[model samples]
Target: MKLQLAIDLEDIQGAIDLIQKTKDSIDIFEYGTPLVINFGLEGLKKIRAEFPDITLLADLKIMDVASYEVNQAFVYGADITTILGVAEDQSIKDAVKAAHEAGKELLVDMIGVQDIATRAREIDAFGADYIGTHTGYDLQALGQDPGGIKLTAAEEIKSANPDLLIIGGAISTVDDPATAAAEFKKLLG
Candidate 1:
């Protein structure tokens, strides 16, 4: 089990500042979709260069051209890159191959997937380093709680493949992020 902090705000410096403040406690740092969209790949590079020891995940949420995008993410210093679960099978396979070849890891984001358990089982068998149940920002703003969804998905994935690392996102909205993160970390344990 690992505690991954997702940085989704607009400012790169603000994200960096927060990471610096909590660097010692978190297990992984995610350059969230908003941050990547705001600052490009440079956002990943800047933070990774500053904290060489922390594992960095770039939430590109790739849907196509997996190999090229995943490769580029690794080149930009991402230890892990994500792809959408709804993407074509070939794309997911390509992403996994690229990640493995680069000695990196791939996370399949099960965001819009209707059958998360089924897809998680398939992705785990296909060798994705992690299977994540992610709730989009819009969904979070609608007052949907991701904690229950995350736990349900984690339990489903754990039963299917205990070896696959399970990640839960959409936690930044929680009133007490520290307690929320700690509770999520315990899900895998």
Candidate 2:
């Protein structure tokens, strides 16, 4: 199986440094949502320039302006772009058209969709190259797994949505739960 590393919680340089280190082992390097949102497509431009031949996936989570966004991602060197499953069916179709026209792939991210089975079946008909899911923290609500979130993700998430009610999992699962909670508190509170 090919390993696709989703690189989030890192700035553009950090992501590039990571790809530089892991390129040999990873099949597809994903510039995740937070990274793209923080650094813009310039991150893609820089990474693509640095690794000209690597398979780069930009996790755009495109919910609107589907065709334009897909084309833009390709122009910036994304081998694959993403569309949200919750988006309108026509938007998904537009994205597929854009990807096919550019000889690239569109991955449909069913991150927050309610009906996974129905959406997956519908998206399968749209010819998306792949259908996938990401762990949406709020949706999953830490559910009892306490270590999947890293400090860095916490900080970025907090920064993006300051008023968001922060939750913790790693802290609860760690040997020193109090210490972990304190650290998150320091970073987020």
Candidate 3:
């Protein structure tokens, strides 16, 4: 029942301000792909320094150089780093290993890939800590539904590996949080 608040499009100060404002209310604080790309790992470090207790997720959307990226993220204070589910098996394994070595978690983001079953299986095989069923900003902007992807991926992953963690994305509004929680419950059952 963790609620991760994604911070995107804002500058470092703005992100810091938002996190400071919402830290007590949110379970996890996510640095969105755009913000990470714009500010780099330093952005993650800054947020971590500001909020030491909150779980910090860096949405790097890593596709290659898995070990290096994971190491860099961990060094910069990311408690969890995200890689693309569509990435090569070796890449996923490398990232997962790196994350384990650093005592952090890896979240495999299933963005464009439609075959949730296969991707979830692959990520689970690699021992990823969490699977992110995400709707990218462009998709959300185009009025796409996040529930379909979230439910499909959650069900597929739970069927394959009941222990795996399923994280829903494109959740910003208050209503979406309740919707996501209900969808997760249905999938778990």
Candidate 4:
């Protein structure tokens, strides 16, 4: 029931700028994978300093050293972080533990999971805070990826579950990011 805007822009300033523009409308602001790759956890520290109270998710998409990485993310001011569901079950458990200990959360991104139902139950048992389905989310579904499918599937997916959280990255590509976010908010409502 919240709008999470994924800021996959190149630099720190771009993330800050987009957050500034859409802050009022977007419920959660994400520091996407590219930002983490480009600026490291230092980028998250800077953004956290800028908007201390906003719900910020650092999409670390962790693959190894779950406890250390998840702890580092929280230390750098991430309210939520992620680990790939395709990772080892122990890694998933460790990430969830670290997130919970930090009073934060870990989203288990099911990008390449071969069997979603089996893994989802295991992830839930491991105490993951969220499960991210679809590859790179709506952007990929809308033909942004090589094997892309239609975005109409996003609506159908949403309609399937009442407890769903839909996060979008398309807002970052538009002329007016705030308007785009507001449109999503309206549509979700």
- Residue 51, model 3: lDDT of 77
Best by TM-score: 4
Clashing pairs in 3: none
TM-score for each model = 0.79, 0.75, 0.77, 0.87
Candidate with maximal lDDT: 4
Tens-place lDDT digits, model 3, residues 1-189: 455667776788977876665555456678888888899888888888887888888889999999999989888888888999889899999999999999999999899889998889878888998887777767878888653235556656566553434343433333345455445545554
Clashes of each: 0, 2, 0, 0
Tens digit of lDDT per residue, candidate 2, span 41-75?
Answer: 98899999999999999989999999999999999
lDDT of every model, 2 decimals: 0.79, 0.77, 0.75, 0.81
Off by over 4 Å in 3: 147-189
After best superposition, candidate 3 residue 55: deviation in angstroms?
A: 1.1
lDDT of 3: 0.75
Provide the clash count, candidate 3. Answer: 0
lDDT of 4 by residue, 1-189 (tens): 666777776599988998899888788888989899999999999999999989999989899999999999999999999899999989999999989988897888898887989989989898888887756645555865423222344575467653435455467777988887776666664
Q: Can you tell me which runs of candidate 2 are displaced by over 4 Å?
A: 144-189
What value does the lDDT take at residue 112 in candidate 2?
Answer: 81
Q: Sorted on TM-score, highest at the top, how do the candidates line up?
A: 4, 1, 3, 2
Clashing pairs in 2: 146-169, 146-170
Q: Please report the TM-score between candidate 1 and the true structure.
A: 0.79
Backbone-clash count (model 2): 2
